[model samples]
Target: MFINVSDESITVNNKWERAELAQIEEISMYPVALIGDVLQRLGMMASVIRHVAGKATFFGTVLPILTWEGDNLAIHRALDDAQPGDVLVINGNGEINRALFGDLLGEVCLARKVAAVVIDGAVRDIQELDAMGLPTYARAVNPAGPSKYGPGQVGFPVACGHIVCNPGDAIFGDRDGIIVIDRRLVSSLAAKLKLQDDVENNFRARVRASLG
Candidate 1:
């Protein structure tokens, strides 16, 4: 289901199944660190939401933008409504006035088996989230409150960094940066990314050996 609120789109899908084909493609094929390398190659700042701690990696489908006056109503709605392996993309418009997300939300997401949370605004309770091992990427962190007013959407196309995120697009983020692969291109991109990772690792190994 999708909720359209003016400029925002929120998607709610209780069904959670990693696309079998995608999973097969991932498993049968050798893994590559393509997403990380892609960011470095592009010389773009489309990665490393940088606000998270611990194993701050993220990859999954997008549940588009949601709005709140510092209250987490829509966010909660999204949670109760998110499919497993879905990434929650909150468009806070880069607002740093208050904390857009916190430990409680993080806990809920973890419990629901959600993949990650990406916000263009702010998040708080970093210590708890990190302890819980929840993956979150955001512009900043603040200790402010949120509103629970109207005006939020789900299952729509939203913009993050320099990429346009649509529902089901593959979003992968690591230390290097975030890579959004079009759902249609996952198979091809996966192969290319895996190749890139192998080549890069071989180069790194050779360089290390020569230094020794």
Candidate 2:
């Protein structure tokens, strides 16, 4: 059954499902930056969406969130609706003062094995996130916590770094940057990317031979 997070029950839909997104693990092997490069730089999030804490490599289908500045109710709502292989992609409306995510929520993501989190605003607890080895990319860090107010949406398109992200979009992030791909294009694009890699490798080999 499909779990729904109604306007009243994002708090209760917080049940974690057994892993069903195993294919994303295989897709994660593709270099996110290279894929974006090959695609002529489309789907890359804003450069400001950067490494704040945790391991660098991560990729997953997105569960996008939209929240008002200085508020994080949508993020909490998305948490209940997120799957194990889903990256919580947040558009915090560029609010930089109040940190919307932190260690406690990271504990939940860790226990549930959520792939990663990318917030286009702010997050705190950098050291704790690093210690847990979870990949977290955010615009900045702040000590002030946010209000849990409403007027937010979950599982919708939200602009992170000027890039509009829809639910179930493929996303990859590393120290280099974050790249988002349309979910429907993942299969065909991945195949083409593999071919490009082979061609590049052989070209490099020929160059080496000529030099030798």
Worst 10-residue lDDT window for candidate 1 reads: 1-10
Evaluated against the true structure, the overall lDDT of model 2 is 0.79
What are the runs in model 2 whose C-alpha is more than 4 Å off?
Answer: 1-23
- List per-candidate RMSD values in Å: 5.1, 4.5
10 residues in a row with least lDDT, candidate 2: 11-20
Residue-level lDDT tens digits of model 1 in 70-118: 5455676777667777888776666778777888778778788888888
In terms of lDDT, which candidate is strongest? 2
Q: Return the lDDT, model 1, position 168.
A: 70
Please provide TM-scores, in order, for all candidate models, with all chains considered together.
0.76, 0.87
The local distance difference test score of each candidate is: 0.64, 0.79
Residues 1-212, model 2: lDDT tens digits: 11233445222223222222454555567687668767889999888989988999998888888887877777766766667778888888889999989998898788777889899899999999999888999999998998776568787677998898878878888778998877777766757777777887899999999999
